[model samples]
Target: MSEAAVDISTSSANEIAPGIPDPYSLPLDKIDVSQGELFRQDAHWKYFERLRKEDPVHFCAESENGPYWSVTKYRDIMHVDTHHQIFSSEGSITIRDQLEDFVLPMFIAMDPPKHDEQRKVVSPIVAPDNLAKMEGLIRERAGKILDGLPHNEEFNWVDRVSIELTTQMLATLFDFPFEDRRKLTRWSDVATADLNSGLVESEEARQAELLECAEYFIGLWNERVNSEPGSDLISMLAHGESTRNMDKMEYLGNLILLIVGGNDTTRNSISGGVLALNQNPGEYKKLLENPELIPNMVSEIIRWQTPLAHMRRTALEDTELGGKQIKKGDKVIMWYVSGNRDGEVIDRPDEFIIDRPRARQHMSFGYGIHRCVGNRLAEMQLRIIWEEILKRFKKVEVVGEPRRILSSFVKGYETLPVKVHPL
Candidate 1:
């Protein structure tokens, strides 16, 4: 951690001030749902509930990331997500504008022709054929991980299980050096860590770590660029016509995008599913009675967890959304976290029902063009892990409260203490 970084576990910029009123009690204009502390404390639900009901397309005139519009309803968020012409993804996808001097131009942050071409370059990796090929390996690795856990002894499941499995999968995707696989996890954290989150001390430190990530990947790029075209991600980028000519920053940007995409969603969901099942004991009982529900439960887990809370877009033109006028260039945030729990679309929105009908209809994987490229892979990983867990464990008990990551952008866990009881 950087010396300049504050330990957000103890103090955070977004912490509700002493004596501040509850989410509904506060003035509508005073509600800023972008606060990291609200998510960290797991106290953000009621805030979004208020916004979804009273002001679905509310604007906060002031926030740490500056003024922005919050689109909380499922339909409105789907509108912003699908209509790329109106809500552009060109600038930054998070509320915080990318630092002018340190901008990294990955495909997710690019528009049209360029974005389409670059996305096509790597999309093949997650295609149906490739996912089928990877399934056996994923299941084999997942079983080995579960077999290694100490029975009836408390341990941080996020570190021991979640991080380990995802890091291994990331290494295989990139064909990276297996011994240094954890570096991918580190870079993912540095790329999205809030300055006050204590993950990195300052903006300078964050950039420094990301640059080091760039240097390491650059070495791999050099190795793969000259070789015959290969199936690994590094080789795909090195040889793809659309991406072959990318400059250093653009390369780094795409690398960070893939790393975070591959790691965060599955890793966090693996941890989140356990915590969710433990909290909703009846759901766990249902799953134990019938393991066939794992696939549907995987989708429900992603919806309930909403690993990535919100994705920000820049309004490209003046538009009317939920009766609010959004001006050109204004930052618009689609709160997927809130939209996933929208009552208008999802029945019993707050409950975690593993066998819920149309479980796949949630917005955890954003809609339209920028939807998660690795959506299938994320689901497969979660399903495989849970299936293996059921085969070996009677239950995986959450013994302590989870410590959540202090960033609204990456809704995830830092640690979750648990104990496994063998079947």
Candidate 2:
């Protein structure tokens, strides 16, 4: 399906509801941060703050996605993330359960030996050697995109820059058809979007679009499976010992994983970094003064954005966390967005400091077995783009309010109006 054919919008989700009470005003048990509307309004911070302070391991007896435990503190989230044995990633990784009829079995949702084996198959794509080879190509693409931006004109930075750059990169990684690159963005959006986000009409529609994605990739797999091993992701999966025999559903699951992982997280971070800089002028000035801080600022951007807000893990065995007893099969959500702002772990947690010490120490990439495999690649893209932006533009000024995506899982932007000033 073409990107334009998919009508995903945040208009309905972005409407501010009447009498929105403060986080503290609500009773403890009544607080549910899983609502997508809160994220759409950028009002989830206070709710998470309240949970981190009073109930680090609070259990929501009810939510749109059903009962789940929220791990808000930095250390507590780290514990759950690292101890995959106690907290399994088996069934699903989001707060919403996967449709039993349309389950997609990707490596990120697998346990033990299976996950490790499947993950190892594609790890080489981002290895030190491969990334070094990819650096020049990425820089070239970033420069062209930046150079092409209209100067002294208000534009949607999310579409022109963030989506364009990341979608191009995803096309490169998958060796997908460059002309149809926007489909990657659409698929990623559809894969993680809340049903009520207006991204799709219903679960059936969502599944249908994803199946179209599956069919397209399956064709690529067929063509590559017979050819000599190539460097692209599809080639790797087609030729790899472990992934070569994956079922159609498993293949589609991994494709969605790679597409979303390669697109949304980095794309949102690109938009978020610009928004963050505009929000914190001092940091932008700090960056402009010493362009050397671009690399460091990239980590800070990821931390500040916390793009993929939370990762859900199902408890394999009953366990206690932060004094809360987590029963077996309970859905446990590690609120990475909240953890990135925990005062106990991050200094001046709410502030955006570019030269912050130990900047890479954040929960955005997750931890342990499932820590983001393409983290370095994501950082590299951010660094190169910022470096290029600095070389040409004095500032990418935010001219209007940024529209947030209505998704508690994928915290991102739908649109961010900006006007570029040449250096």
Candidate 3:
């Protein structure tokens, strides 16, 4: 793997309107990073800028399972995200799915009225006021998780801190049986990781695990559907109206989606924030000096880490972009990791400054109606977690190399070994 070289896709060079010149032409699979490696680094920014300027809308024909277009420019993604009718999210959101009727969740897989309908049930539940109520619980959990970290010992922050805290908090919110919280996080990771990738296969073990999650949730949803409305998301989901009520099957599917969406992504953010801070000690010091900056620093971490790097969006109609022509049914990969560091939008795009002028404008949470439903909760978690970290620890240092996942879709650390000391 060449540190200076970034993988660039060529489909855009042929079909895209002339915008930027392609510097490196490599197969999409060639550009992927392993779990512990620092990927999509400064070099990635150069490739993205070249694409944005020359072929802002290019295609990567050799994604592991299939070919897809890479959309790197900021405005192009925004345009596609806004025009949901033209650039649809429902048909082919993931590149490796081979199912017939297997859309994962109601809202994440829908457009407009239906998307709005499904999102309405829980959007209010995660709103600022509702999220504010969760801060105390989140802080308590974050403290317990961090405090329990072994003193004078190195540990993988991903499993010990990131996954544990995020999943436990998610269980708290979902009213899930806390004993099964780890099961929820594991299933969510497997289900969302590229199916073609080896992590999740058609093996009986995988199938049984998935069925276990479904059966557990099916029972929970069945009870809630008949019971009265409560404050938790499950109660609202059970009681919410639609053209038809979401049956136990749909509720289970949506539960898997929520658990995955809310779990791994934010867990990655929490872990990634620690990594970014350790990498840039100055930034870490800034947060420690003025803990108030924790809120603003959350955006910087999202941009720097870009946990769920890019989501696949299929085009509903033939479209022309950056001089390139895209056909109907074409799959476009929105590289939010690239777009967040777009040279046109961000200054010193490669540098990790904790307080960039327009840091909030980054596409880490994504754009349009599909913007992360747990975004507020994610920010709340980060702010409170780090605020508590600052109170407890004076210094944090990465003790060893991080292990990154083999799959390309969910970009995050598999193992982040680090050591921390109390102030």
lDDT digits (tens) for residues 244-287 of candidate 3: 37754466567776887788788888888887877778787777
TM-score of 2: 0.96
For model 1, residues 34-134, the per-residue Cα lDDT tens digits are 98987787778878999999999999999999999999999999999999999999978888899899999999998898999999999999999999999
What lDDT does each candidate get? 0.92, 0.91, 0.72
Candidate 2 local lDDT, 251-296, one digit each (tens): 9999999999999999999999998998888888999999998989
lDDT of 1 at 77: 98
Q: Which candidate, 1 or 3, would have the higher lDDT against the true structure? A: 1
- The C-alpha stretches of model 3 lying farther than 4 A from their native spots are 1-50, 101-105, 195-198, 201-207, 247-249
Give the least accurate 10-residue stretch of model 2, judged by summed lDDT.
Answer: 1-10
Q: Give the candidate order by descending lDDT.
A: 1, 2, 3
Model 3 lowest lDDT segment of ten: 33-42
